[model samples]
Target: MSTDLQWLLLRKYNSYMVKGLPEGPIFSKEPGNLVNIHSHKYSGLSNSKTIDVSDENGVIQITTRKTASPHTIASTRSTSNIRARSGGRRALRVASAPAKQGYRPDLRRATLARVSALLAAQKEPKAQPAKKPRGKKTKASA
Candidate 1:
C-alpha cells in the first residue's frame, strides 16, 4: 500500500498497527524509512511494509504495501507467503542493525493496537422489529 493508502487502512482498522509489530520495525540509523517484517514466533515473514525512518533525528514518515487483498479466513499457507514477501522486501530496503542494539520489538503495543482497531471496526447486526399484540376474539355477527 502507498503511504496515503496505508494510513487509510490503519484508519479503517482504527489507529492500530496491523499484524504483530508496534508501528512495525524501527531502524535507529534511519528515521523515516520502512523495513519489512517476519514473525520469529511464527517462522515466516509478512507481505506488509513499514513506515519510513528518517535520519538519527526522531522523525519518521510511515508507509505500507497491499500485501494481501481483503480476504476473510486467511489460511496458514497464504499467511506464510505474506511473511516471506515482507522479509525479502525488508532485506532489500534497510541494513540490519548492529548486534549490540539488542532489538526487541514492542509486541504489547502492537497487540493492543490490532485488537482495539478490529473491535472498533466491527459492526453489530441489526435487530428485528417487535410484533404487534393481537386483540381479543369476538362472537360471530350472525
Candidate 2:
C-alpha cells in the first residue's frame, strides 16, 4: 500500500550561494573602475543601496539598493521556501557538501521535522500556578 506524508510543500533551490566569484574582471586585467563587492557586504551592512570604496581601490561598487545586476534584484528572496529541510540548521549538524540536485525525500522529511519542532517549542506551556497549602488552614488565616 502507498503511504502518505504530512509535509510542507515548499519550492527550493538545490544550491544557494550568497556570494559568487565576485563581480569584476576575474583578475583585474587592468585595475580601473572594476565592480567588486565591498568588504562589509558580508557583515550585513548591505542596505538596499549602500556603496563603499577602499582608499587603495580601483573599482565600481553597485549594491542591491542600486541595480548592481538584474540577477541581484531578481534573485530569490530567501531559503525559507526550502522547507523540506534539504539542510536544516547546517550548524546544528556536520556533513559533507550537499548534492547539486535530485529529489531527496529523506532531507525533506528532516527539514519538515525540524520546522515542526521549532513551531511546537514556541507554544507557551499552560499557565501553571503553584499549588496552595491543602487540608490545613494557616493560623494567620484563622
Top candidate when judged by lDDT against the true structure: 1
- Backbone clashes for every candidate come to 14, 4
* Runs off by more than 4 Å, candidate 2: 1-78, 81-102, 135-142
Candidate 2, residue 13: Cα displacement in angstroms equals: 28
For residues 80-125, write the lDDT of model 2, one tens digit per residue.
1222233435412221112112222223333334334443444458
RMSD of 1: 18.4
Task: List the lowest-lDDT window of 10 residues for candidate 2.
Answer: 1-10
Model 2 pairs whose backbones collide: 34-59, 48-65, 49-65, 85-111
* Residue range 1-142, candidate 1, lDDT tens digits: 4545544443333322245456755222221112322222211122233223222122111222224455732431211111222343342222222111232232323422332333333335579897655554223322
lDDT (Cα, 0-100) at 140 in candidate 2: 50
